[model samples]
Target: MDSRFVGIADLVETPSVAVVVDVMRACTVAAWAFAQGAERIVLAESLDEALALKARHPDWAALKDGPLAPGFDMVNSPGLLRSIDLAGRTVVQKTTAGTVGALAVKGASLVLCAGFVVAEATARLLRTHECDSVTFVVTGEDGQADEDLACAQYIARRATGAGTDASEFLGRAAASRAATELATGVRQGVHPDDVALCLELDRFPFAMVATSEGPQMVLRPCAATSPTDAASI
Candidate 1:
């Protein structure tokens, strides 16, 4: 089996499995949410859709662009989820890069969200499912984000039976211009701790797979213990 790394702009054909990476925050947040017992994560491509979903399911947490809304449980920050109990809850999330990149790879046989937290689990799932080919899509900021690219390469290495030292990748990400800016300044709603969370490799034991339920795309645990429990999560 072989895996290829590509940027969002170069995603022309979907492979057997498409692992989407947005390590700056989005995918990392999703991974932590699942680990903290989030029932399911529904991805919305736009703020309008996310708000509409939240309106229909008021109990569900909604995360959109910009600051955390007054009524929403939290924004797209892993640090915020640390103290929150997402147990048996469904969360609706909208992000600038991750979810959008996920929706773009609609042709994939399997769509899985990837970050440091779920990297090992993702590789295990890929091997267990025997995917002949895989595509790692780095959902960079506007173009190519170093963090996303590093995460993609790490996953690629792991999936191919090559051992991964996440520290190297994390070092690259931390030194990136995007990370440097975030660390040096106090971005109003952005938290530096969230960046730290994104770099924590293999923190969770499960991988998040995107599945279509009716017209919506939802993320659920892809482990053998609850393979068919998409509705439950």
Candidate 2:
């Protein structure tokens, strides 16, 4: 199998599987959501759009990050995510990086979200796919972030059956600007605990897979136990 990393803007390859890496928070929040039993996640481009969807489905959880827009359930945060119950509920998420990149992917048969927390599990799921190429879409603000690049590399290596050191990748991610913001509280209102939460590795045994449902991109948890839902695209 061939594996390589590409930024969101450079999504030119029609890979068998595409893994979107937003390790700083977005994908991490998604992994956490699935781990907490969220029924599914909806990716929206803007706060207004997310709010509109929420208005239509009040019971669905609404969340947005990057300045923390109003008229939503909470900021895209894992600490707060842990406090809220998401079981059997559809979650709508708007982010500058993660969700946008996820929705932008048109060449991938199977789309997935990843962070350090679930990087390995995501890789295992990728291994289950019967294909020859995989792309890791680094969905950073500028289409590239140190944390996201490191994560993509780590996941690619793991999925390709190559020995990799997780700490090296985790350390590179923790040193990213986004991680620094969380630690220094530069990103006010977002908890510092989020830094630790997102950095912690291998938290789940399932993969968060996204599929297009009409105009909406729905993300659901897929167990990495075999060639299950994620392997089918």
Best by lDDT: 2
lDDT of 1 by residue, 1-233 (tens): 68787778888766668989888778988987887788888999788888888889998988764587765668777877777888988999898889988887866778989888888888877777777888888887654788888888887788777866778998998887657765765443467687788888888877888978888888887772344444233
Q: Which sections of candidate 2 miss by over 4 Å?
A: 227-233
**Cα lDDT of model 2 by residue, 1-233, tens digit:** 68778887887656668888898789988877876668788999787889999999989888888455567877888877777777778899998889988988844688888888888778888777754787788888576689999988888888887888899988888888888888887875487589889888887777788888888888887877664453221
Which run of 10 residues does model 1 get worst, by summed lDDT? 224-233
Give the lowest summed-lDDT range of ten residues in model 2. Answer: 224-233
Q: What is the TM-score (0 to 1) of candidate 1?
A: 0.91
Every candidate's CA RMSD: 2.3, 2.6
- Give the lDDT of residue 93 in candidate 1: 88
The per-residue C-alpha lDDT of model 2 at residue 166 equals 90
In candidate 1, residue 61 scores what lDDT? 85
Q: TM-score of each candidate?
A: 0.91, 0.92
